[model samples]
Target: MSSSAVGHVISLGCRLNLAESETIRTLIASNDVVVINSCAVTNEAVRQTRKAIRRARRERPAAQLVVTGCAAQMDPAGFTAMPEVDRVVGNAEKLLPASWTSHAPALVQDIMAVRQTAPHLAASFSAHARAFVEVQNGCDHRCTFCAIPFGRGNSRSVPAGAVVDRIAALVDAGHREIVLTGVDLTSYGPDLPGAPTLGLLIERILTRTKVERLRLSSLDGIEIDDRLFALLTQEQRMLPHVHLSLQAGDDLILKRMKRRHSRGQSVALVERLKRARPEIAIGADIIAGFPTEAEAHAANTRALIDDCDIVHAHIFPYSPRAGTPAARMPQLPPATITARAAALRASAARRRAAWLDAQRGTVQRVLVERPGDRGHAGNFAEVRLPPHEVGTIATVKIERAQDGKLIGMPA
Candidate 1:
């Protein structure tokens, strides 16, 4: 338990949530307060949020338990109905200092009306070796299966100047690696002046800052423009790992999901990336058993694990969220969804194992994470190494692969 006198900030869901949680942590001065930053990406995510609320209440009986984040923003009354919750704060209000101490029991604003991106200006994260900077927020696309737009509003971006300044400050504060994160990462900069693209923002950061290792969050395969593609493949400072938001692999399923990318486009993008940089690793988010998904559809998604060479895969079973268009579609049986999810997970595990095995006897530069025993390679391969100084980049020689991780010694 890393509890301090300022209290506990429990963040759930995406990397953006983790980044916001750090900012939330900095705002709290009150004691005996437990802030639950919740997620509502899926029905299962909402259930987990409720479970976390109950558990946090049990853990801190006397503390003022506050619920905030996407879940709270989507359904404030539902969280407010919980006996364990003292206050329910929305995504828009959670970062504001007044929300924490306000007497109002429920504070949720009209998320769609919000135009400006909240500046999460927290300079440092004491617990992490890599700092995550939220350069964008919200999503412009309304995918059939997603309810996140209701929670996060329309797309908005922090200006490139502000983002570069933030990255520069983090680098000056000794953060060696800076990860640019957002809800729709590739959809960044369209809302800002001069309508800069994400590629231009990265180019500015590289030109303006002395940041050593720059990484990106999940990107939409369809959004990779020519300029961004070149920087991703050629820039030495930019990490070689690319995670795509490819929800499904079947073209029909992707169309039904309202995704912009086709199956062939995603595959070709990865192929192009690998052709330019062989060391570049591919990560993707693939969903199993979407609405009206047949066995052939599931097969296509499974094939994507191999076709895209997805070494880092985030597989989710189809969970119909309330108010999503996909929820109104013909639903799959619970057992079928669970079985397909398991199958996809098994495929992903096998692919990941093979990738790790192929990494044996290779030399890698690893960014040592907290506690110093392990770190991740530039390609985002997890490596277990001897104790080293946390946050220091170490060159390691791979010895073996064990339990889905590369075991190595510092070179």
Candidate 2:
């Protein structure tokens, strides 16, 4: 990699990481650097991070390799000890430009001590058609199975003003859609002055900016305040899609996980959402074979696909992180975990296929991601359509559902 070339940024994990990697890409002026923005959500994520470091080293032998993000923050020494890694930067320090060039072998800090969110992290320019805005960072809730809070520190939110301004900038730059990303999205605003809710921030952005389509990332169902609920059900500009961080569905498993919501509550929330906006698509994260999870627990989780009408299901076979409470609990056998995960995925696939088939012959307004290619509908359903201008919304009439996508043409 030449010094004048754009630095290679390997972003692994959630949409938040993609948004943050854009900042890292911008901060580094030389191509002689490779940054691995890692994820530590699972042991698999950490393994992939390490694999990426080795791969980058082989691909770009002369380029400096830097590791940052949750994996690096949680275990900086492990990454620094790798021969392929030149330096290791923590989640907090990764945003700082000085950390990139500093001779320090590791820039890990106590993330818990940090309180404020950097406003510059508000928008991402990496994608041509859609832009992501980071409105919140970190998490306050410590689910027994999760290690994100430790890697991300306490929850903090970007000011509504900054978010609105950044969104407006993206709108002006021709991005048709703006997605609000965060570690704990629904946990936004409690740290800010006046404790303005996420709904209020959305209201501000909609009223203050010309942003066409507004979307939200993974949200905790329990934290959906009445105001936010009203907006989600009634707002036309807010995309008709909601992705919840519903880890599991069994009441016993949920209680053991220390989650705030129950299985009944989750079902009720989805019912209410669908009743108000029938077109609203639901997505969720479900863990299969969690610690102490039984066959009944797995069945309850699988049932969520049909009960919640979950088309976009992200299933993770539980992997024990180093310090999480779940790691100490009795774990299911590896074979059992794998089988449960496959079963959950199969259930989701069947449900998703039915949902897609239901969309046949319907009309959808798609945000054209690429001209003459594909984009996504308001409900976040992927749609393949005839040629249309990139970054423009086009009305498409569904012809059929194929390969898990809606094949359409200009309506």
Please, what is the whole-model Cα lDDT of each candidate in the order they appear? 0.92, 0.90
Clashing pairs in 1: none
Tens digits of per-residue lDDT for model 2, 63-166: 88899999999999999999999999999999888987797999999999989896656344745578888899999888999999989999999999988888
Steric clash pairs (candidate 2):
none
TM-score top scorer: 1
Best by lDDT: 1
Off by over 4 Å in 1: 2-5
lDDT of 1 at 202: 95
Query: What C-alpha lDDT, on a 0 to 100 scale, does residue 388 get in candidate 2?
Result: 82
Candidate 2 minimal-lDDT segment of 10 residues = 119-128
- The RMSD of every model to the true structure, in order and in angstroms, is 1.2, 1.6
Candidate 1 lDDT: 0.92
